[model samples]
Target chain A: MRSVVSILDLSTSEINELMNVADDIERNPEFYRSKCKHKILATIFYEPSTRTRLSFESAMLSLGGSVISTPDSKISSAAKGESISDTVRVISNYADIIVMRHPKEGAPVVAAMKATVPLINAGDGGHFHPTQTLADILTIRRTKKTLSGLTIGLCGDLMFGRTVHSLIEAMLRYPDNKYIMISPNELKLPEYMREALDKAGVSWRETESLETAMPELDVLYMTRVQKERFFNEEDYVRLKDVYILDRDKLKTAKSDLAILHPLPRVNEISVAVDDDPRAQYFYQTLCGKQMRMALIMLLLGII
Target chain B: MNIDGVNNGIVLDHIKAGESMLVYDYLKLGRLKCCVAIIQNCQSKKMGLKDIVKIDELIDIDLDVLGYIDPHITVNYVKDGKLLKKRHLALPETLTNVIKCKNPRCITSTEQELPHVFKLIDREKQIYRCAYCDVVGDNK
Candidate 1:
C-alpha cells in the first residue's frame, strides 16, 4: 500500500493533482460526498492535537467514510507502552487508512512500514508533516495565484518547525522560488536543508529581522517557537517572544502579502492582525481539511 | 615491528592512523577465534602514517563499516599465499545498525527492536543522516 510519510513522497505532478482535487472539493463539496462510502479512517494520535485530528475526522465524514480515533495518547494503548509497529498492525485490521501523529520523530515511518493499509503522517515530532505542507501549498496556490516566482518568507522557529521544513521541501520543487528565512541564529535552518536549497540552485537568504524581509514577500509563513522541541525552559522562554507579527509588522509588508500560520497561536501573532485582510491563516485551516480529503482519496485509490 | 603474511585470509591496509581501534571494534575482530594482527603508526611514503590489520583465517568482513570509517582503506583477499583480489572502499549508500541516532526525539530511541538506519546524504563531506529523523549521525 502507498503511504505518505514525507512531503517528498509525492512528486510535483502529484502535488499539482492533489491541489486540483482540493480545489474541486472546495468548489463542489456535495458532489464529492460519499466518495469513500464504506471506507474507514483511523486517526491514531500519540500526542494531543485538536486541529489535525478534527481535520482528518471531518475530511472522512465529508467523504461519507467512518472514523475511529485516539484523540489522546494517555488514554490509548500507547500509554501502556505498546510499540508503534504493533499498534499500527492491529489498527490496520480495523481501518482502510491511517493518519497518525506522534511525539517521536519517525514513529509514523515505523507505523507506515508495518501498516497493511495506507498510512498518512499527520505529524511526527519535529520531522515531517506532509499533509500540513499540502494545506500550506493549497493556501499559497490560491492566495498567491502561483507557486513559483515568489519570495516566500519563513519566520520564527525554522529549526524545530516541521511545517517549515516540509514547506521548504515542497516549494523548492517549483521554479524561481526564493526563500527568505527569518529567525534567530540559534533557530537557523539545518545544514542539510541549506544544502538541499543550494543543490537545487534556489536563491535563499537568512535574516534575524522579519521586517527586513516583509516587504519583498508574496507569502509569509509564520511558525511558533515550539517549547517541547527545546532542551531547556530558559531557552524557550527567551526565544518564545522574540518575533511577534503585529499590525506594525504588517504595515511594512505588501498589501497583497498572504500571512499564513499553522495555528494554535500564542503571542507570536497579535490577535489584532486576525482582522487584517492579509491574514489567511483561518482560510488556511479550511484548505487543510480539503487537502486532507484529497490526500485520503488519493491514497485509497479513489481518485 | 613485522606481522606475518596471511596465507588464506584478509589483509586490511592503508587505514588512517589513530582509526585502527575503530576499525577493530567495528569489525569485531576481538570476537574472532582466528589470529588477527593490527599494526599501527607504520611510516609510509604516500601516507605519513597508516595502520594495517591482518587475519590468519578467512572471515567475513563488513566492508561498508570499513568504508564508512575510512574510504582510503583497502581490503586484500588472500588464498594459498597469493593475493586473490584487492577491494577499494567507498561511502555506503545506506547503513543499517552501524551507528545509532543520538536524537532523543527519534523513534529508534524508544523502539528497542528497530534497526538504526542512516543514509549517505553528503558524499563529499561523508555525512550520514538518520533515515528517520534526518539528524546528522556522528561520523566520529
Candidate 2:
C-alpha cells in the first residue's frame, strides 16, 4: 500500500533495508533471478529519458518481471487527450506495479492516487527522484564502506540538479557528514534547501572554487552544467567550463578520492580521467541497476 | 427592511453581490436535492453589496471551494427560527480531494482518476500548492 513518492517518505530503517537488499542483489545475482517471476512492471514515461527508463526496464527483466510500457506518450492515447488518471487506471489493471516519469510536478503522485498497485516515481519535473537518490546512496556506501564521517563535495548545477537536492536530503541523515557545494553564483542551491540543511544541523559551505574543496573530499559528485538552465548565452559561456574535472584539477585531489557523475556528460569530465582508479561513475551506473532491482522487488512484495 | 425567517435552514451572508451562483455552482448545492435560495445584489451596511444562499438542509459546506471562489461569504446555521450557529468559512489547512491545479504540467492536472489535492501552505498570502508538483497558485 506504500508508494515511493519522496525520499522523505522513507524512514532511515527502510532506507537501510533497501540498501541491504541492494547489497545482497549485488553479491548474489543468481539468487534473485526469478524472484519477480510472473509480475509485470508498467512504465509510463511522459517525458524523454533514456537511462532512467532503460534502467527500470533492465532491472525488471533481470528480476524475471516483464515490462508494459508507453515510451512515448505523445504518440499514444495521451495524444488523443486521454487523462493520466485513466491511463494509470488502465495500466494498473495490467501491471503488478508502476514506475512513472512525467514533465509535470506531482504527476506520479496523481498516478499513485489512482493506481491500485504500488507506484514508483521515476522522476517528476524539478521535484523529487527518490530512485536516483537510492542509486547515489548505494554508490556512496559501496565506495566509502560507510556513510558517516565523509566530506561529500557536490559540484556543478546546484540549482537545477534535482539529484543534488535529494542527495543532500539523504546524506544529512548520517552523522559527521559535511557538504561542500561548488557552483557558479548564478546556480547556487535554492534558499529553502539551504535552510533545511541549516535546520538539520548539517555543516555546509558554498564556494565557486572546486580545487580548494577537491583534496578534502571523500566523494566528488559532479552534475552537468546545463546550458538551457542559464538565462542568457553569455552567462552559459562564462561558466560552462568553470568546473570541468581535468588531470590538472585531479593533481590536488586525494589518491583515494572517488569521482562520480550522473552521466550523459558534456565535457565537464575529461575523457582522460575515465581511466583513473578513482573514477566510479560507470560503477555507479551498475549500482543504479542493482538498487532499482531491489526497489522493484520490495515494491512488488516479492522479497 | 423586510426579511422573512425560515425554519431549520442555513443562511449565508456577506457574499459579494451577484456571485451567489458562482458560490452555488462551486458548492454544487443543486446536487444535494435540498431546497435552496440564492439572494443576489442585496444591500449591506458592512459590504455595501452582498449575496446570500439559504438552504433548508444542514450540510457541510465546502470551505475550500468557498475560500477559492469568494472568501468573504459567511454561513449562518438556523434552527427552529433561531440562529443556531454562525460561522465565517475559512480556507482548509490541507486541501485534499478538491480544486484542480491549473498547471498543465502538474501531475494532478493530467491524471484523470486522482482527486486534485492542494494544500493551503501560505494562508495569509492566499497561496495553494499542488500536493504533487509543489507548484504554488494564488487563490485570488
Candidate 3:
C-alpha cells in the first residue's frame, strides 16, 4: 500500500517482510542511518502523544532525514481554522512523508487522501496505530523469534486501547495464537473486537484473573486506562486500579515471558518492576524507533 | 379511486404507507416537468396499506434507491397508456452516498473527491460497513 492508514492494509506477507527489514536495521543500524538523507518527514500530531511524536521524529532523524513537525494541532494552522485536509496538502509539498496522530478517529485517513506523499497514521483516536504495532511486531519477532504459536495475554483497558485492537488484529493472522484477555467487566474488550477474533476463528479465553493466566502466557501486554478515554468518572476511578502489575504479580508469569506496554503508563505497571530482566517495555520503546525506521524505508520503497 | 392511469410514466406500487413522501423527495419527483401523483395510505390486499405514485412521463429514477428505502416496492413502466414492464424491488447489495460515515477518521470526510460508499457485508444481519473506515451503517 502507498499509504499506511491501517495495519490490515499490509498483508501478512508484507508484515513479515517488514519484520525482516526491522531485524536487519536492529542489527546493523549504521547501514540504514543514511538511507533517507535529504528526505523530510513531517509529524502532525493533533493529539499530544509525546512518545509517538518523538519516535517518528527520532526515526526520521536517525535515518539522516530532517523533520518538520507540528507537534500540537492548536499550535498549527488548524487552530486558525485550517482543516487536516489542507494541512496535509501543504505539508506534502514540504515533506517526503507524513506521520499523523489525531483525536478524530478518521482524521489521518482524510489527510492521507489529500497528501501527495506517503502518510503514516501514528494513532488516530482509538482507530489504529500501524507504526506502534510495527514496533510491537518487531519486538515480538526479535524476542520470541516468531509472530505465531504463542499465548498472548492482553491486560487492562481493552475497550480504549488502540494498541490492543491493532495488535490483536495483526497477530490473529498467524497460526495458533491464543489470547488471554484480562480486564474488568467494565472495561471488557469491545464486541467488535470479539467478533473479529471469532470471525478469524482464533481461540481466546477471557478472565478477570491475570495471575491464573500469567503462567500460561508467553507475553503479557499491560495497558493503562486513561481517565479521559473513560466516559464516566466513577467507572474510571473503580477500574483504573483494577490491574496493577507488581513484582508479586510478575512472580506468577513464566521466566521468559515478555512484558509489553504501550507506555506513558500510569500506575498499571509498578515502577519497582522496571529493573526486572523480563520487563522489556523500555526495549519496546527503542525497538519502536527501529521499527519506524524500517517502516519509513518500506513505506518509501527504499527497502 | 378515480385517479387517472399514466400514459407513459412510471408507477410505483406497494410502497409502505406513510413512507412514500420520503421516496418522493429522494427521487426529486417535484423537479420533474411531468405530472406526478402520490397516492398515500391506499388499502391493499397484500400490503394491508400501501402508497402509489403515478407519473405522466417516464423520468429517470434511481431504482436502487427505491429498493433501499422500501424494498417491497414494485415499479411499472407505462407505454402509450399500456402496461410495459413490471419490476420487483430487492435490497441493494451496496449503497453509495446514502449513509454518511460517522467516523471522523474516515477518508471520505476530508477527501471531497471520494464518494461516500458502503458495502453490505452481512446480508442476514443487514450490516453495512464503510469501505474506508469500516464504520457500521444501519440498513435503513
Off by over 4 Å in 3: B1-3, B13-57, B70-74, B82-96, B101-117, B131-133
Q: Write the per-residue lDDT of candidate 1 for residues A1-303, one digit (tens) a residue.
A: 899999999999999999999999988999889999999999998888899999999999999999998747898888899888899999999999999999999888888899999999999998899999999999999998999999999999998899999999999998998899999999999877888899999899999999889989999999999888899999999999999999998888898999999988888999999999999999999999999999999999999
TM-scores computed on chain B for all candidates: 0.96, 0.82, 0.91
- Runs with alpha carbons beyond 4 Å of true place in candidate 2: A227-239, B1-83, B86-91, B96-105, B108-116, B120-128, B136-140
Error of 2 at B51 (Å): 17
> What is the alpha-carbon lDDT of model 1 when measured against the actual structure?
0.93
Best first by DockQ, ranked:
1, 2, 3
lDDT over C-alpha atoms for residue A175 of model 1: 95
Q: What share of the true interface contacts does each candidate keep?
A: 0.73, 0.85, 0.31
- Which ten contiguous residues of candidate 1 chain A have the minimum total lDDT? A69-78
Deviation from native of the Cα of residue B52 in model 2, angstroms: 15
Which interface RMSD does candidate 1 score? 0.9
- Residue A68, model 2: Cα distance from true site in angstroms: 2.9
Instruction: State the displacement of the C-alpha of residue B73, model 1, in Å, after optimal TM-score superposition.
Output: 2.1
Task: Give each model a TM-score.
Answer: 0.97, 0.78, 0.88
Q: Report residue B129 deviation for candidate 2 (angstroms).
A: 3.9
Candidate 2 clash pair list: A85-B111, A85-B112, A105-B133, A106-B132, A107-B107
Predicted complex 3: DockQ? 0.36
Please state the Cα-based DockQ of model 2 relative to the true two-chain complex.
Answer: 0.47
